[model samples]
Target chain A: MLKKGGFVLSAGLVVLLMVALIYQIKNKYYLDILFMTFFWASLAAAWNISGGYAGQFSLGHAAYVGIGAYSTALLYINFHVSPWIGMVVGGLFSALLALFIGVITVKVRGPFYTLITIAVAELLYISAIQLKELTHGSEGVSLPFKPGWVNMTFRERETYVVLALLFVALIYFITKTMERRRIGYYLIAIRENEDAARALGVPVKEMKLLATVLSAFLTAVGGAIYAMYIMFIEPDSVLSFAFSIQPALMSIIGGLGTSLGPLIGSFVLSPLDMFLRESFSHINGLNLLIYGFLLVLFVLFWPEGLWPNAVRVYRKWRSGGVETKS
Target chain B: MLLQLTVSGILLGGIYALIAVGLTLIFGVMRIVNFTHGDLVMLGMYLTYLLYKGFGLDPYISLFIVPLALFLIGVLIQKLVVQRVVGRPHEVQIFATVGLSMMLSNAVLAYFKGDYRSVQTTYSTDTIQIGPVFLGVPQIVAFGISAVITLVLFLFLKFTYTGKAIRATTQNRISATLMGIDVRRVYTMTFAIGSALAGIAAVLLMPLYPTYPSIGEAYLLIAFVVVVLGGLGSIPGALVGALIIGVVETVSAYYLGSGWKQAAYFVIFILVLIMRPQGLFGQRGAEQL
Candidate 1:
């Protein structure tokens, strides 16, 4: 659906980003930021499929992230499975969980559905803590730095950045394809009005479940990748409400339901997050304070999100300029 | 032992009822889930802490002031932020409230640095003997006060002109507006009343529980469970739901363990939401959800 000019602009920006990535390969800090950008972009894209496109607006997505991270770390630690395989296992596990929740909440809507999602995530979080013997509990699990391709651990930070970028690209491509497909239409229809969608032969429950499962699977994969990159897995970091909020915030700021919006949001917000965290490390909660303000500001003034707003502004400027000349 | 657990549970449930009443009132009237409801309670706790620390004010005395203070804050919040999102989409309302919740909790965290604080009243550790169950004096007093406030709220909603207007608006916003009830004013008043109720809960909890920036986070979920279990907008539902949750919590904690108590109730919450979303006292067709 992108216009020619927009497509060219985005393609050119991608090329420039690649060049920057290559040039900053040696800079660990820059590489870290780059990895985060791509990582959040992927997570937000995963959320967008269900939350944005299908209107699930789940506030408990961190459960999938935690599941993925735990699965990969646990499998690799105990059974010596490759992270590649473990990641898939995690994705399946998260998908199952999502399917169960989605089925139960299929008829539920609005705040009630959102509340159930929160309760489900909290249930998992509590379980992770209680199942201390298996999941390591709140003390968290740390992976040995056995740098190897099979382990998905690399000596160079560049590899992780590339992996993250590739992951985000895969998510974007899948989202774009879905947006052009019949399932996307069905999801949007269901989102608009479940009854109307069902009347028009759209399997609303099945579509919502499909969206939930797909979103969960993709998010879990991102979580596994994050665990491998960070070499640590913890309930507090991965399973926290912040993790759930971050993806939604990114998607909302970037433009909900749009493929490119999440990418733009992550690229902007991730760097800002790092900057805020660094600058205000001593001042606890300052970063989150700012995030809260931004969330409020955006919802109040620019509910359409950054990408759509930018597009509108650009179009307005272009038309205004033409009119002045005329 | 079971009786003791049940008594404590009932007392705790009284406090939970106050919080849930506030939440349910806002939800029932505005059709908006005030996610920041817990944070308002947290703010109340801090206000109590400050009053106790600075002015040597008893928590009971601050109870009167704190709720009034929070009611004003609620008025400001409803007017400045919530007003714009009124009648908007559910997602918009959700984000606005969630965002405000984040801000309030974090601002408190930033200012307070996550230290847990509590009021050291004379009766903080005092307990009363009643039929083989020794209950904390604070718990009994808090329960008594909360029950009274909830009753007052019920009667007010039933009799007072503004309260009836609030009820009318909750039942049918369009009709209330058509009748010149100033639906927006009812919304502001309802939100403020909810905030005041949260303030009351916070004051009552201060003697028993420590105050922290994230203290509200735990109560936030419990409040949701209570509000949902009791039925979304029913005050009586909140009271009954809170008591059920409280009993379940204590009984499970005794049998299963402390960690699993929360899990037990959460499981119940999920089942109830799935099986009976309208809850026990809520009208079947009251909520579209």
Candidate 2:
């Protein structure tokens, strides 16, 4: 769905991001931000498959993340398994859970679906907290400092940044492949009008389930990466409602239903979030308070999001400053 | 013990019914999910607390003022924020209120600094003993007031012209408009009424639970469950759902443990949604609401 100029611009931006990463290889703060940007991009892109394209708009994605993080951590801590393998196992587990949820929820529409998603996530969160023998409860699980490729743990921040970038690329590739295939259009049709899509002979339920499964799998993998980078997994940190909202927030702000939008959103907002959290640490809730206003303002005025708006501006600028509505 | 648990559960359900009814009424009329609902209840609690502290007004007496103030605030919120996104995309609509919820709860967090506060009244700890079952005085009083308010609301909706207008708008907005009903006015009025109901719930609950900025977060999910279980937009359904949930909660707490009480209701919520999507008292096509 990207245009020629947009493609070139994105390519240029990617190269620039790589160069910056290399230049700031030694700077821990910069590396942290870059790692998080890629991490969020991966999540937003994965979420967009179901939330944006399939129109699932799930607010429970963090459950998958928590699943992946906890699964990876528990397996490594208890069984001495590699996180790379554990993440796949976690992803499969998350996909199974998604299939169950999707089968039940695919028929429900609008806010009801949203409400269920929230409830399911909260259920999992509570379970995580209560299953103290397995999860350590709210005290959280800490991974050992075993810096190895197979472990998916690294001593250097730059290594984690590269891994996070690979995650972004992988999810981005899957998103693009979905967009190019018939399933993408079918999902969009299902999103726009499920009844009509069903009338048109599209497998509405199956497609939704597919989207949910895939979205859950990728989100779980992203969560595993997050666990590796942070080396800590806590219900409050990993399974909080904020975690569920953040990926959707990035996707919405960057622009929904677009491959590039989520990346742009993560790249822009993740740094801003870190910066605000750092500067306003003493103010408690200041960042979230601002985020609340931002969500309202954006939804009301800029509902189409920044990516589409930026493209419009770029096209306008390229057209020799013409004021044409097109 | 079981009887005591059941009595306490029923009393707790009274407060829950008010909150759920307010939420369902708003959804029925406006087709908008008011995510800020829990926060509004929280706001009511804070308002009552402040009134009690500043003016030494009993929470019982502040009840007269809090609901009215909440009604005005609800009207303002509807006109300013909820009005613009009445028929917007689901994401837009959901996020709009979710955003509002965040702002409100966090604003309270920032202002009050996360302190847990509750009103101390003469009846806060007082209880009535009847044949080996003990009932907190505040709980019984709250339940009584809640029942009275629900009855008044029911009468008003059944008999008053404005209430009829609200119901008509809910049943069929296009036809209601065609019939010379001001749908917008009905929406604003319904929203205000919903908030006022939540305010009533807040006042009743102050003696029962501690007040905190995030206190609403605890109740919001339960309200949603009650609304869904009673069938969205069905006031009577909300009442029944709240009672069922309250009983389920208290019984599960007694049996499984307190931490598992929320789990029991949440599981019931998921089962109901998956199995009967329309709820026990809901019409088959209540999904349209």
Residue lDDT tens for model 1, A43-94: 9999999998898989999999999999999999999999999999999999
Off by over 4 Å in 1: A1-20, A319-326, B285-289
lDDT (Cα, tens digit) per residue for candidate 2, span B98-156: 88888898889988888899998888999889998999999999989999999999999
Report fnat for all candidates as fractions from 0 to 1.
0.73, 0.63
Give per-candidate clash totals: 0, 0
Candidate 1 global CA lDDT score? 0.89
Measured against the true two-chain complex, the DockQ scores of the candidates, in the order shown, are 0.77, 0.74
Model 1 scores a TM of: 0.96
Q: What do the candidate models score in CA lDDT, each in turn?
A: 0.89, 0.89
Q: List the residue pairs that clash in candidate 2.
A: none
In order, the first chain's TM-score in every candidate is: 0.92, 0.93
